[model samples]
Target: MDIRPLRCRDFRILMTSGVVTMFGSFITIVAVPYQIMRLTDSYLAVGAIGVVELVPMVLGGLWGGALADAMDRRRVIVLCEIGMAVLAAGLLVNALLPDPAFWPLYICAGGIAALDGLQRPSLNALIPRLMKRDEMAAANAIQGMRWQIGSIAGPALGGLLVTQVGIAAAYAVDLATFVVSFVLLAWLRPAPAPPGAERPSIKGIVVGVRYAFSRQELMGTYVVDIAAMFFAMPMALFPFVADDLRSPSSLGLFYAATSVGALAISLTSGWVRHVHRHGTAVLIAAGVWGAAVVGFGLASDVATALVFLVVAGAADMVSGLFRQTMWNQTIPDELRGRLAGIELLSFSIGPTLGQMRAGGMAAAIGLRGSIVSGGLLCVGACGALARVLPRFTAYDERTSPHGRAETTEPVQPADPGQL
Candidate 1:
């Protein structure tokens, strides 16, 4: 299995867009919570904003996936990007107002989150069309790297900009990035819509959901991911941990440590081509992740917690690479958009619900206890998933049941109007 770098022109464009978008997104992540806190001075209201965003995000991905299957994916992505840009500009204007009401912010957050939901699936679907079959893992690794960078950079940068300048300045930066992303997307060629697709409707969404669940392997993967995220995720209680173990200022360091760990793994992912049994690798990674979470929960000092976080992040990066490759290769091209959407929805549910659960658990049992319980549950969940889906756990990447070759040569750039 030969792995190629994303040296293709369109892939380069997409990668550049990712860089800009991630930087801008980080700004918003920081600015939104800060602004909301400044306005209401209530932790409850700030927390409510997260819930407000999650609803639209899940729905948007579902609907967007259906639309991507029905229409040209490039068009779907471009439209979403444009909508995102408009929303960012609106946020900028709202920030400038003498007394920006909370309702408008909520509305904007929901809209942006919804648009992001659509953007993610469409983007994932488009990647396979951009690259060859064999390149999926490598492409996903690169994509993972982009996200790792964004996750690390976005929050810290947002905090700096918000603290030094203002929320408006951070938003302005986000708006600029949206524009750049849109321009790059515009330059890319369109991808073929899922064949035999009709107009977008509720029925179409249903069809997509059915198609996604029809596959045992894909369904199994979603189940495993959901279990991991729902039980192991401790992000919501990070603030509490920071307060307990260190100053608020040191919170960003923990985030950076996680990102650095993920980045280190992704940078060396080229060596991953040597691994024959991706499924086994995924399970090992998941187990390690669970152990790291347990360690993190018990850590009394910031350094110990950070060490656990880095390990968790590294394990997560490896799992993500294999999982994404499995998804891209297993699904048919026609169902890619819809399946990707369903997958995205499943992905969102676990983390969102987990965060909410973490918050409540922390309040009830103390941060360390809540985290420890979550970690234990995570290990149990993974074990349950493996036991229930033994066939899926034994699946090997060397042989795909799908008609397409298990591996293929690199893909060439498509004509702009081919889709």
Candidate 2:
């Protein structure tokens, strides 16, 4: 809503690049699953996609964060874009094979996931360098909007492309997006490592982990999100919920409901810039997300269920905006990437495990029961967390030491070893 951040040339370039790449990335996301289903026709094989990408994604995120801090962040982003483009080309070629190799699909998917992990930390960590600290919420909101566009339109268009044209066409589009992203990223100013920054290593990563845990506020962000996602994220149960509602055809609507809500929030996020008690804001928003999920679970009809999902989605966007602002406002620039990497894992691991949890619980209980219970657990977890970490709940941007220190000295304690 606040368009002030868009005035910066580099930020504009970066955001435009993100919009293009995310759109393409989502296209490939839909295409890959459809291709895999066509080739194997096994639910187990389709499920294995997550398993295949897991380890590589985790390692890539941690190491990528280290890499972002060690070298030029811009260079890291550019190189990863190139790598992803090559992977997309591979997907395109494989899709055109006389008998497309199933293994290559998995291979390419895993490879692309790794490149995504590698690229994101640098991408996120570079934001503060491009915008004034006070503009972080607007910047984060714009980025969220960019992602929502991809999530909503990319799949719709990709489905049409795959169904009407071919899988190869979808991959070709994804590859083109990477090319465009690379060009835009090339225009970004250099974001070099701090003078005393150490090369990326196992030790450096451990130091980053240690620093994150040492700060209660940072640790609170990670754990609270993990709890919220692990319990309340119920995407894995959408199909079952759709069936229960007797509107299996409306499955896509169920998926889109949350995105629609989140997009609405992103489009009208001007008010977020005024709220400085980020920790409290996150807690409230996450709790609302959980409550909405519970409402969704209790809804017996498709329309009611969708309304709850929309509310849940809007709440999630609010939490994400505040969480990101907290990170950017307080984190020292030198260690931003590594912290972002840990931040990545905290958010990523939750949804992955949440899907697994949803399925397991759905099997153990009825569909509605799983959704209801998870939502209750998510809400309860937030309350418990607030009680346990009072400092996090009380965090105020105006008076917090981290925020003050970041404003006064943008560069400090460059060496992880010294921490």
Clashes of each: 1, 0
- Residues 138-209, model 1: lDDT tens digits: 888888888888988788788888899888899999999999888788888656565576776788888877
lDDT scores in order: 0.80, 0.89
Summing lDDT over every window of 10 consecutive residues in candidate 2, give the lowest-scoring window.
410-419
Instruction: Name the runs in model 2 displaced over 4 angstroms.
Output: 404-419
TM-score of 2: 0.96
Clash pairs, model 1 backbone: 26-154
Writing each residue's lDDT as its tens digit, candidate 2 over 74-175 gives 778888888999989999999998999889988988998898889899999888887788899999999999989889999888999999999999999999
Worst 10 residues of 1 by lDDT: 403-412
To one decimal, what is the Cα RMSD in angstroms of model 2 from the true structure?
4.2
Alpha-carbon RMSD of each model: 2.8, 4.2
